[model samples]
Target: MKFAHEFKETLERECFPDHWLAAAIPYSQLKKCLKKVQRELESLGLDKETLQQLLAEQTVSPNGEPIPLVRYNLDHASSRSLRPCLSIFVHLRHGQVIDAALSPASRAFLQRLSGAHSRPSAIDSSACTTPLATPSPDVSSDDNDEDTEGELERIEVPLVFDGEFFNILQTDVDSLDALQQQEEKSMEAEIKSLGAEVSAVVGPPKRLAKSDLNRWREIFDLYVNAQVFFSSHELDHGSRSSVKAVQQLVWFQKQVQTRGLLQSFKVPSSAVAYSRFLQLNATLLQNLKFQEINKTAITKILKKFDKRTSLGASVTFRSAIRSRNFLAGSVAKKLCAQLSQEVVSTVPRAEDYDCPICFSIAWYPVRLRCSHLFCVRCVIKMQRENKKHCPLCRDEGVMNADLNNIDKSLEKFMKQYFRKETEEKQRANEIERGMEIFGDQYKHSSCVLM
Candidate 1:
């Protein structure tokens, strides 16, 4: 059936992607094919106006953006009674379309329409002139014929990524794991060599304090768990591959609700930190492989925190000792980067990284004095409007100082980890700018006459 004008308008209003709409079978073409059974359809009490209304009612569902329609032929239609029989077409991503069947209705009106079977063969001559197929009461027609008969029986539409893509991802993950193993061996060799040199020069190496080793072990624990989490979370769903980042996120989120891996693991920090750590590292793991852990950064943090229990060390230490929290932002970055390897994964949930106001990941991130974060461009706009307080916390006197010192850590993190999302956010921002500058002509970029 043809899509109603209202239906098309609704899809357009929702900004359904143009490439997707272009790939589907046209509504007009489907309507043309349905006309072959027009006489039969009318006999079943479905005139043109009534059919149009029915088509319009089922055309636009709110389940997904622009909704999905099913249109397929019935393989067993000749043996059944005809009432409100419909064909279905399931739309999958990247232009794959599959045909399905519509379920039979049990309404009183449909029962009346198909009641002619109860009478003898002496009904109207017109009914004999144009015979229609009957629909089966016992069989559910919603399932497709081919789907029921195949190995992938009763599979839903929007099929997962093919085997080739999964193989590629698996190879990449294996390579990353191998690389991490090599790095560990190299580090071990370097540590042995350094120990030999120190023993020759300083008589003999001193025994390490229990506290210092325990702290490093805590940091290492956090690193290992984060690695295991990012590595296996995608593999939790057996065999099937997702074609889109959003789909991966949606499936993973559902799995997280049912079977969480981190809830029971005792970490050096709060349980909430485990989720945040997984999210942060998982975002990085999608695009990068495990490399050498930043040992220099870790060492610097550890040295500053380690207490001077050794006799001679107490004289050199005058200031207060700063203990490192392995879960802290700075330390976690160094540790997670070293342990986690990048593999096939989704673009991170935008809410985890985006500034709440501008909703973009670009244009200089600024951490407010009170710890609220925003993009610098948005901050300037706030200043111009005399919004002197932090929008989130409502803390006053933000305008007292020039808001400089861009949050370089966050900015660098976004640039390094979220390359794909950065491009998307920038493109959306550019489109917004174009609309403001070019007015109505922005959409008609190729119109030479204008």
Candidate 2:
């Protein structure tokens, strides 16, 4: 629906009280209504002159009477569209006090008119009209029901106006268009002035030799491609793997250097950049290598890089490619590359050792003093069971040597092995209980038959 129609419908649906729309009545009826309202104003304690002044300024139409001036063009000087408004004016009466009734625009005009003794009679007459004591129209039961159902029929009638509404509409449109056009021209001029100022500071764009420009573009493209690769690879690994993708990313640095991409970009060499890159790659690879990885570590690395980037460090551009610090950065990069390769190579191969406890693959096999290479779970269970001897070797007092400080590889195996044993035992007990219950039920049934 058109915005104007929608707005009108919304206003009607809200059902503003009679007081709000009381101004939309015929001028004659309005005058009659004013008299009664004036009396009510007097009863409210307003003096005679004040009441008259208020009555003269106020506008109110009689009950059930359509306004004589359907469309009011408020100001002749205002844009025609803006002047011809659809709002209704209202006058309020408090006891004997009669308030001046006027639409928002008309009120503003009245304020200006109040400074003068001899104001236009038309304005005064419009404000003070004859009073009508007609009773309000009663809605039919069916109409009331329909209103409750949220439906109201539109009553459209040509709005009676003193002058042509179309003329006012045209005038408003013209004025609005002129204002908008002027604004656009002003904006264009401002932009042109700004561009000239910026050009003066930056100097005219340099004209590079064709060959040099082409080479620079190629270098730029390489850096862009590398950034994209790193971003995608980082997302792919997201704490699910034993290999650090960042380490593999370091390998791309060689290509950047070999192609002289860095020198072309004029980036500064900083040890900090190299150090951070190495540290991040090291952390990632260490976790992967040790099989002691967590999502937090990966997230931390990303956060560090983000911080560095925010600090104006170029981690993924041609500038980063050229620095002397790049050589040091290569170590972490190489490690990442190697780690990635290891992951790919190991994918097809089955794990040689499995956790006896959890029965899953043992990443870091820890051997207990028992000489038994059970997964970490199995060792932990043995310790908890207070069995100092190795489950396999039966060596006594083995748990006394600070089990917490034991090698990670051995701990991993024992943990896994003991977990498997515990699960098996639990399953066996459950089965036994089930059998016992069934036997008792069978016995009870036989006794009942007897």
Candidate 3:
């Protein structure tokens, strides 16, 4: 299918906001402008075939590296439209043909244009319109000594349509960048507000009729495991394509629904906050989709531009354009970092602070000299076994660890966030210690042994 039609259909089907639709790249118009560029090149007797040959011609430098005769530059001319300057090195050395790659017609065209010292003619001005550019002289190299002295002189090929096309493209990209920044700020604020709301419901341990701490913790755990929109797995990078993000999102939503998280919300506002959370992700996904398609459109147009004009603009265009966010940065990356910091981090995940030895919450977390943490019981057992090295880093801090190793701050954090889990772990540790001292015949007792 024609990309222009496909681009139009995707925009319509996506049902993006009208303002976003307005800011999208003018793919159809750019295609039309490309046609004009092709025509403009042809009018100067530089057909695609002629240009391909001329552009392919190169001079072998004294160092044996090939220097391109035609240096096509698309750079910011003082923050204006990316001015594409097609600077061709004209061999004025006795009007001799520069490269064997040039066809008979191309050789003659270049040679004639370079030798011209008279006032610019219609054909010469069309091809090389700079005010200093002279007309193509009819005099051969044999007939004129004046054309024989100088080496290659670089001259600019004046083509307006392609420049206009770049201007239109760059302008739209700038607008899209601005729009994305505005949207990002709005979403960032929502993330902050939502974080505070979720924290209020789940942070404290005292159970109320409206307590939904466990439910929220489970929800967040499931959300992290699902890795929706971004992967945090060791093997996989956090970056996910919008399509994969959609799949992960769908899976996450399904898990929440199947587990009946919404109906179980004791705090009424938690459900509302959850809904807003989903909506925020949905909005982000839609924004990602919009950015994805627009970026694809940009790629297609640049490829088409190169295919038609042979300017190889796909690579050059991206570098030339003055865009920092829209094209270069990912919406998911920036927003996901904010979501992790503000929202997900509010209700601390227990697994993050689990002991490596027991794979459980590290109650009375023992911070080894290596900074690796374990439950106090695990450290005592390791010491009893005469294992002196840190299991993770092989640091010999295990035996050296004393009361100072007890991370008081970390213990307080675990107690605050994992109160029930810590209580259970404390009971288990006591039972284990009693059995170890009493040769497994000791009866577990909660009361103090008088």
Ordered list by TM-score, greatest first: 3, 1, 2
> Which residue runs does candidate 1 get wrong by more than 4 Å?
1-350, 359-363, 397-403, 437-440, 443-450
Tell me the lDDT of candidate 3: 0.79
Better of 2 and 3 by lDDT: 3
Best-fitting candidate, measured by lDDT? 3
Query: What C-alpha lDDT do the candidate models reach, one value each?
Result: 0.37, 0.35, 0.79
Error at 162, model 1, angstroms: 65
Cα RMSD, model 1: 30.2
- For residue 253, model 3's alpha carbon misses the true position, in angstroms, by 1.1
Q: Model 2 shows how many backbone clashes?
A: 57
- Candidate 3 Cα RMSD after full superposition onto the native fold (Å): 5.6
Residue-level lDDT tens digits of model 2 in 1-450: 643344345335545334322311122332333344334423433324432333344223433334432122232334233222222222212111112332344444323323232121122223222222211236554553454221111111112231232232233334333433443354344334433332232221234511222233343344334442234455563232323344344554566578775465322322222233334444544323322211222223223322321211122222212223212232233433443343222211112345565565443355555555554445555777887776555777446545443467444433433344334544544454556668644322112653
* Sequence-dependent TM-score of model 1: 0.23
Per-candidate TM equals: 0.23, 0.15, 0.84
Superior candidate under lDDT, 1 versus 3? 3
Candidate 1 C-alpha lDDT tens digits along 4-115? 4434554455443453234222333323333434434444443444434333433322122232232211112122211121322222211222222222331223433333
